[model samples]
Target: MYPTDFIERINSLKKELETKTPLRIEDEKRLKKKLRLEFNYNSNHLEGNTLTYGQTELLLLHDKSTGDVKLSDIEEMKAHDVALSQIEEMARENERPLTESFICELNKLILVRPFWKEATDFNGNTTRKKIEIGKYKSTPNSVRLRNGEIHEYASVEATPAMMTDLIDWYRENEPSMHPVQLAALFHYKFVCIHPFDDGNGRVSRLIMNYILLKNNYPPIIIKSADKENYLTSLQKADTGKQLAIIEYVEQQAIWSLELSLKAANGEDLEEKGDIDKEIELLKREKLSKTTNFKSKNTVYDLINHLHDDLWNSISLQLLKFKDFYEKANNEIILNHELDQKLSLTIRDNFNLFKILAPAIKIAIKDNHLDSTDNFYDIKNLLWIWSYSSNKTATKDIEETIEMNLQLEFKFYEISLVNNKYELERNGSLISTTIIYQSKNDYDTRITSESINNILKSISKQLIKQIKEEE
Candidate 1:
């Protein structure tokens, strides 16, 4: 047994499994649906699929689509969901002793409608190829390492025999090996074989979960946020250093069990410390470095004045601005009514800015506004205000506020380099100008026209820079 809390948790989970008290119908349906969606989303995301969690939820839950993602991505997400349901059904129906035929069926189900792909051959020459759905590879397959050396897998002729040996080994070891170890080892061996021409990673992951599910364990998810660690672990496994991958998957499995235990007890899923914890951690770290700007103008006063001006500006009419709250992308929108209240809150509690900054950063990052390559037209983004208190200010005076306010526009250059998202510094722009009440600072009079013009300027340069990089 590993010397970790997760191993202890696994032992506890073993006891829970012994309960044999089946989950409530509502809990069963809810947990299964949530796990299916999360598993499909995270697994596909690891393979560089571009569907957002929001898009995945919309598509899988409501048959709705958002954003300008590719059709192939959409189709694959749907197919992956179908495959998940099939696997869960198999687990629930007492299907055991998984075989090559069953694995192949899953592979076929995942890539339900496989198509041709243009890929480089083993010799580094590009060629058009057909990816056989649900079948073994017809040609040799290997991966090029970071050092430009190819790591070849078993020959096409040897793949079938290797897979058979793998299954036989699995069957023989099942009785003695812990289910987690069995699943992890199988996942490692299957990935090393690279059985199919495509969808090998996704299929291997599916098989790993199948092993766990068949053993009355919850499915483990490899989140995309840990993509780098996951890949590095796999690479290490290739070098006979399997501990990293083993521990990583075990931690994920522990997390899965935690969620399952909670759900079975009628607990709210949000209590799980995952995506929310990440957001909070990121906020704490990123906001700590924010510089404070001192000024005589209070945040409340400044925001109130700007709000009234923009509220009655002709430029708002020219820009077809709405009278109330509306969604807008990169283009910044300001609502005096809302801003007044938010500004006051920040004024009273400066530390609250830490929370706000991370919220804005997440919104920008998740929406892909930072990367020009993935920018979404956020049609209605209201002004995001951040502030801090001045120790120099007398205790309760409103004008003595030390709120450092700015409309920050940070642009990032992204390239689809080698079919991967790479950040480039060629045309990256970072603008942070503090808003002040100095009479000479004409920029203080924020208007819809000025905001729109600024977006146009930044986007134009962004587009040109991206084109040049391409």
Candidate 2:
């Protein structure tokens, strides 16, 4: 259903790409590395694999899945990349025709093993279904859309027949159809059947690229950032506007071709600072493009990340004075609003970070916000943490945090700062840092060495004040 101009455009790009038949070794390696990582990352990420792009690259290169991530996600990413390699080999075997066996095998490889999955039966009941690696679905697998309507795939009894028909149709059309149209349509029909239980989405994408690679086109990446558009395009296709999805895939194909052309010219694939930008973009990829910054988001994330580490570092050294100040608490205020009024407390800091690296995500992805002004106070408290700067307070309100206590309370009152910190003892000053930027760069200092030094000075100052008063 492609327009004449669109088909001609792909053909023109395709013909010019053929002239650079044998790209330089370095260029080929760079392009392959980029494509392999991008495809595995975006494909799994779309299906909710929690590994960041940086984590994915580390896993692919050094076999290190950094950050707090699931063992299963690491294995899936590794296996999925291996499957990409396997498909590359499969695509090169021009003598062999595409088959259902290969597709099923690809699924088995990506999934790694059989597992139990939560599924919705046709009767609209939640059921725990056993998912076998490489097996077609035995139960009715359907999904509920955002609109609260059920979207059904082919019937369980008809799955085998439909899959066969799909494979037959693909093989028959492979020689005559434009590869982009062939791949896009195959992906559409296969996902419609929803042949397998869990990996259908990932497999459909893998096979889509397999079709393209067979025709010597670079693999197209449907980026995780554009997930809504990806799904919406398919939803429109479901409405009989088939060209909507084809056009979407065509645009991706053009990007792939342009990159390949750049590689053939021995040019850099990524722009300046693009790698850091990719990491940053992928960092927020889990936070759907639709997500707005909120308070539950701030306080929850505040407790999970380096905040606890900041506390642990400060408290451990301060522990020597446990006899005098056994338990101390910290709080945040906005215009005289108390901690009880705010959503944060010391107890909120737990191993909650193990759930998902500072953003337990599941912590609060809802409309429940503590502030009427769209949680602006919460946002400032989370990002630019400091007392003197009064970041947590609005201009209309007086926000007071203790940089240094009066020493009359027989203890030290500490404040988290945006950058620097100063400790005072009998009106003398010692400058150091308590909380600095974290590796993730998500928060303000709230440091170990500085905390220890400042705590020592303050404890001495408080003891001297107590003695003098006595």
Candidate 3:
């Protein structure tokens, strides 16, 4: 719990931020950008993000980087930016109460998919644990303190109950407690629980900020340089002196408050290196302003790359469902033909494809995408399936389920399964596979990651549809 003076200080700052009530457009831009960069840089740095403040600015603000940095660092930083936007929007909706599912989704946002790490248990044994995105930890998690003592967290069996209690405690205390104390206390309690396998620190900080932002206070950033002090305050709190962490957080909150106050008054909000970051970004963008025309980047290549990706995805995944039905036969109707008609081709006919590609290109160019940009709209799959109801031939085939799957691929996203039943989801897994034109001409092929998301979404829908019918 915070002392009266501490609560007073935070409220005083919050009241000051409120007078700015509806900041000027430019002022809001400066304040919001600074807070975002500071929160992202410091929080991630505390967790050992190798990117410097400059790199963080370059990547997050400008969408370009000068030097070689770890890809994971870039990804996590970008992911954190997205998560920041999400939480900010979430904080504005006072009508919507926070739930455990939102917390799990926050975990997923901060820690993206296909991630693995080396996790060590309390007994000093290590195992490679793949991150189960949006899920609680199945194994134990602990920290080793000074004097070689192991500080353990809530057990797997207790985590669920503990998390529920934590949420209940917050909802009960929210209306009564000061925002600063409430947010800090929640952070401390979450750290004690460590519900997730990774990104708990980041998640706790974001959730803490969510509380502050919702209550009209500028979010604080625990400077990565102060990792020791921050941890020390937490360490102190762990030992029953609750004020230490709350005091430290309040100190950081004051800095954010002052910065925002300056922005409110329309003063120069740029720090020392802000100009240099801007200059570097300008230099990079200047070099890559105009995209060089590539003949190979026609709609044909787009359709081709997309066809292989979707066909392979559909073939490999849909075949698995064959065992689910007694008689299952699928016709992959990839109608990228010159005439707008349906013909289920077992394989893409090269001669017909060459003739059809230009017509499809002309059609898309006329309607949706540009001919000069070579982004001729999209390609589609109109696949149909005929299946017997039962997998085992116990009786005569009384029921037949005909399923038609429609897939459409645009520039960077894909939408699949919009027919026979209501199931559709879009995926943003395109990282230089479907699009052929690039600053650096990326290899024109499908990534396994893209295929995997498509497979998972499609398989989930098909399984549900089949089960419902049966």
Question: How would you encode candidate 2's per-residue C-alpha lDDT over 207-252 as one tens digit per residue?
Answer: 9999999888999999998899998888899999988788889888
Candidate 3: list runs displaced more than 4 Å. 121-123, 272-470
Descending-lDDT candidate ranking: 3, 2, 1
Which residue pairs in candidate 1 have backbone atoms (N, alpha carbon, C) closer than 3 angstroms, thus clashing?
327-379, 327-380, 328-378, 328-379, 328-380, 328-381, 329-378, 329-379
Worst 10 residues of 2 by lDDT: 404-413
Q: What lDDT score is found at residue 456 in candidate 2?
A: 66
Q: Is candidate 1 or candidate 2 better by lDDT?
A: 2
Candidate 1: tens digits of C-alpha lDDT, residues 188-213: 99999998999999999988998888
What lDDT does candidate 3 reach at residue 69?
A: 48
Candidate 3: TM-score?
Answer: 0.62
Best by TM-score: 3
